[model samples]
Target: MEQITFSQLKKNLKKDTTGFKEIKLAVLGNCATQLLSHALRGYAYELKIALNVFDADYDQLEPQTLDPNSELFTFEPNYILIQLCSEKFQLEFCDLSPEEQESFADRVMARIQEYWRRVEARTKAPILQFDFIEIDDGVFGNFGLKTQKSFLYQIRKLNMLFSEAASKDKQVFPIALNSLSAQVGRDTFFDPQLFYIAKMPIQVDFLPQIAKRVFDTVEALVGHFRKCAVLDLDNTLWGGVVGDDGMEGIRIGELKDGKIYSDLQRYFKALRNRGILLAVCSKNEYDAAIRPFREHPEMVLREDDFVMFVANWEDKASNIRRIRETLNIGMDSIVFIDDNPFERNAVRSQIADLTVPELPPEPEKYLDFLRKSNLFETVSVSGEDAKRTQQYREEAQRTESAATFASYDEYLQSLEMVAEAKPFDSFHFARIAQLTQRSNQFNLRTIRYTESDIKSISEDDHFITLYFTLKDKFGDHGLISVVVLEKRDNGTLFINEFLMSCRVLKRGMEEFIINKIVNTAKENGFTLVEGEYIKTQKNAMVANLYTQHGFTDRGNGIFHADPNTYIFTPNFIQEN
Candidate 1:
């Protein structure tokens, strides 16, 4: 792949971004960031985001944040990106006394946090804090890492403190420039000549990578990210074809160069543990495809690890479509990995918007390539994420069991589905916020919220929030739905936000939720319940959702229901 030069990205500044989503970003830093400002915008243009940047003047990181009426506040950024270079910071560290130096990390964090507090107090935008890159001054050489006062130790310590601060405050998301510098050798990442000539810490050659990392987080925050990894079984997961290479013949554990596959498997398992779904797609016989996962001692990913497994002789593209449909996720939100160039291209040609990386022929580079691609970047993970595979497995079982019953309603009743719908609490704030961001297809109004927003909504008297959790004879669907009802001055209870996870769709959850909403409106003495369906490329599934729930479409996406006349929709779900 050809490198996207900073100059190349600069050319995109003039490109018309008419239809792109407008995402305001305020970039503030201590160093000269004029070039970086354009580079970020350019990269955003490439990603179909109209990134309106409020690039602050050089070294104005704090004053702009501290002032309540500053242009930074006026910009009203969706994200605030700060890049404080080590060149300026390390000089400040050198001026401090030995005692101050030892505690320099803590002192710096105190000031950094003050900036965060000032910005957050002014606006609800999430701050994207770019961490310090390495400064290999080589005074103490390798010993500097162990010395607390050393610039090497202090900078790394400062980065750790940034992470610690971000963990405590959900609004602060630290971008790992330190890791990026380390990945592409520090010398290649930073140019001493460039820093001395201009206050640029990062080389122009590396600015695109920095911009990409920032936008990766931005994309994820805006509810656009890959959620699943659809992998080929032969050679991609294992080393060779499991159909031809028998169970013992496959190169997985003890075979020559099998450690490569083993290491990659460990990484995939870690990904699954973190909430990303895994699906298997192979053009082999069903028995041959699944035998390794079930019987092979060397296999790290078991049959249960996959949410869906398609092992048919169909074209890989058709199989991937089935997997995407079964999962009910956008085709773009999946990453397909195959060792064969033909298979990868075949899928790429057939499936628009799908991500299919041309894997290296060399087996050893496969894991590193995918890691560097950063294919599955996501914003938040809840306890529900870790159990996603199991939940999907249960859904498959329910599907199978439904086939035995005569009617769908009878099947739903047989499961004895129970749901808990109640006001939002502090305990589920993270999950509630996550659903607002990730639940795309069923979302009405498509409004996104952060954890801080969720907390604020829960405490606001003008808003009524409800989060739903479903459990049945099969398994629990943890916190699948969120409704934010805003009390309006027009004698109506407005459905400000309505979204549910697609996994729980068509299971009477919508009926159950609508019933709850109408009842709440009646109890609150609001006769009119207003709703809307703002259409999107992916949310067509909910275009007529209001009409289906007995709400009259008043045209132009506006919907309304009279609570006094609202008939309770029949549902199999029992409110527990």
Candidate 2:
């Protein structure tokens, strides 16, 4: 594969920019940025995202970032990428004494912190700051690693300072250009000719890579990350078919060329540890496929690692559909990996939204393919994510048990469910923000909030925020529901946003939540409680939610109910 050249990207800038997710980006830098903007838009289009870039003037990042009346503030971008030109620091570093270098670095750090605070106060957009690439003063050589007096030492110290500060900020995320440059050698990453001629520090060949990093970060912020890894058996898991080769003949474990399969299994297990759900979709006899997982001594993934194992001779597309149904997740949230091109093409043709990466013919390159492709980019992590595999495994058991019950209502009653509701705390703030960003089908209002926005709501006195956790005879479904109520001046409590996880649907939890809202309104001495159902392409299932729950439609997406006239009854869910 060849690198995308500057001439090609410039020629393709005016192509159609429709039919993709529109992302607004503001680029403020101390160098020329026109070419970078074109490259970013070009690469983003390939990833099914359309970028609208707002590039500031050359070397005016300070004025643009700090001034209230600047166009940067007016653009209201979803992200602000601040690229600090290395030239701005090179001259100062060459002249300062060892004591003066400390004071100078401190001043730079202070200025950066002040700039971040000013921008954050004005807008809710996240800040992405670029870390510095190495610049050698040529006098100290290897001694720069030990002495703070060296310019390279001071620059490294500044990078450390930036990272420490960003670690604590929920809204600030640093782009590690130092590490990126190291990966792609600095000689190839920077072009001195372009820097002197056009004031562009980054090379043309490196544009696509940097642009991908930027787009991946944006994709994560808007909740486009893949959640599940669907696997294939036979040649994919082992060397040959289990039905034909048998347990002793098939190549896995200690056999020749079998270590690659073991390495792949360890890789998948690592993904499972980081909250990616694993499942098997194979075409073999159920018992034959179960032999390796149950009896094989060298198997890295046990029967419990996978939430669902669909081992039959069904078509690959049909098995994938059943997996989607059982998991209760959107089709776009799956990443299907198969060793056979026929199976991969079949799934791709049937399901246009699913991501199916083409695997190499050899088994050794499987890990390399996964490492290079940023298919599972994420920006945040929580305790709930770590326990996701166990949670889904419990759900599978619950599904199997439901078959024994005569009716759906009988099954719901037998679970002995208990829901614990609480206000927003530090532990659950990240997960709540994540839910709001990702929950589309069941979300009312469809308003996306960042962690900082949620924190502000918790601190504000006019809003009441609560999250619900559900536990049944099966197991704990962590933090499944969120509700935000705003206190209005006319003694009406307005539901700002309400959403729930789709896994817990059709279980009478909705009725219990509405009853809880009504009771809270009565306790607060409010006259009327109102709710809304804004229509979106994905949220049509929730359009008539308020109407079904006994709220009169006041027109224009508004529904209101008088708290005194509302009659509430106990349901299957017991509130704690």
Candidate 3:
């Protein structure tokens, strides 16, 4: 997220956004929010998203939230943003008694959580709450942290309490303005003069980047985020090429400038630990590229660390395309990192959708530059994420094993794939919510659900929700699919949502799921099973999904089938 000048953002307000994806957002702030609202909408245009922010009237947060019939709810926003400035918070804290200040963090949290619950009670829109940035009045000086009644103590405690609250309630997302303030100097992050004059807390010069950060979180929540990082080996991963430098000559560890590369590896390792897949795309012989990972004692990344390793003389672009195809992810969901400008430009030019970061000339600066860029921000992480690399490695094995079989059906049958479908449970709510937000190409209406939404649907008698998982000889594809059916009064079951991980495509998982849907409808005494295919930019793969599952197209994007007469689709997958 590059910084945009005040004028640049104002000019962006006039750009065309006719076809961009529109997201309804409700903004409630304690200070003037008109500029922030405009900056967000305009910055979103750069990302090809039309952010429709509905800024509430000045200082009307409590009244608008307390009133159920207010315009806030009437707008029906998909997201709700509440920004309460530190400037306001400091003033409020100063007015408190010493006894009251002792519980300042708790008191503030209770109030903030009230807003969250009130918003959730009125609407299911995800709440984005801005946490207070750091502020010290030098009242207690260095001892403020030890003193519970100090502003420094309460402010830090409040941020932690806010994080814990957000963790317990998945509907709440805390935006870290404090972290941003720390990164850019506080002098740049806040404007005392602007606050006094126009009631705007943040500096105009920093609004563009701040707006971009907000949108980044929004993008991740809406199922648009990077999943993989493609790294170039030479100076990118180590100091020199393994082919030319040989095993003993390459610099990777703490002998000299090699510490830089090691630091970079550690950062990438942290990313991998949180569920991002790592892959190698180097221009060297497979043996030479594999040697360092296999034999180098100084190397932090082993051969097993990467899910996909493509080392050949082929053009980097072609290699990247092959990697994308194997992973079953869009090109946009990848970040290509290389120390060589030629390689970065070559790959970026060919793949317009891929993210390529510009590394500083100095190797030491690479990690900071990439970290500051925030290329891999995600809203949630599940246990399934940490095991992602292993799962993909298993997938590669499955693909290689398939080539040995004479027939595709025989290959699938040999794998002994078993699928388990169950009602939505709290244990899998995180993964289920993630699937709804992440799965795109296979999603049939493309409706995203938060964990709170999943919890509600699980208990709602009017809806039938099923979470599906597939396991085979290779490994378990954890929570691969989700199906939500809305029970209708007329003995018909409407398929409200049908989505699955694209990695499990062409494995008869679709057929297995459809058969179960039909059986479930019949068991529940639903005579008719109704569905629809809503076309999206990425979901054309499932445009004819209903028709393929023995559903008769009823025109206008609707389809129907008689559950009593529905024949199960043929597939080798067995129910567990």
User: Which candidate comes out best when scored by TM-score?
Assistant: 1
Error of 3 at 269 (Å): 1.3
Residues 312-415 of candidate 2: C-alpha lDDT, one tens digit per residue: 99898999999998988878889998999899988899999898988878888988777666678777777788789899999889889999999998999999
Per-residue C-alpha lDDT of model 1 across residues 1-576, encoded as one tens digit per residue:
345998899899999999998989899999998999999999999889898999899988778987888999988988999988888888998899999999988888999999999988989999998888878668789999899869889888888888888888989887878888888887788888998999898889888988888888888888889889998888888888877888888899889988889889988999998888999988999998899899988889999999999999999888999998888999989999889988887888898899888777898999898888788887787878899889988988988898999988888889889999989998898889888888889998889899999999999999999999999999898899999999998779999999999988888999999999999999999979999888988899999998998999999999999999999999899899
- Residues 1-576, model 3: lDDT tens digits: 235676787888898889888889999999999998988888878888877878998888888889999999999998898888877888999999999999999999999889888888999888888878878867999999899989999988988998898999988887767888888888877888998999998888878777777877898899999999999999889998789989778889965689988989989898998999999999999998899899989999888889999999999999999999999999989999999988888887888999988888888889988987889988888889998998999999999999999999999999999999999999989998888888889999999888888898999999998988999998998889999999998999999989999889999999988888889999999999999888888999999988988899999899999989998889989899
lDDT (CA) for every model shown? 0.89, 0.84, 0.89
TM-score of each: 0.98, 0.92, 0.97
lDDT of 1: 0.89
Error of 1 at 40 (Å): 1.1
TM-score of 3: 0.97
**What would you estimate as the lDDT of candidate 2?**
0.84
Off by over 4 Å in 3: 1-3
Q: Which ranges of candidate 2 are over 4 A from the true structure?
A: 1-12, 16-22, 44-50, 85-91, 100-109, 134-160, 176-179, 248-254
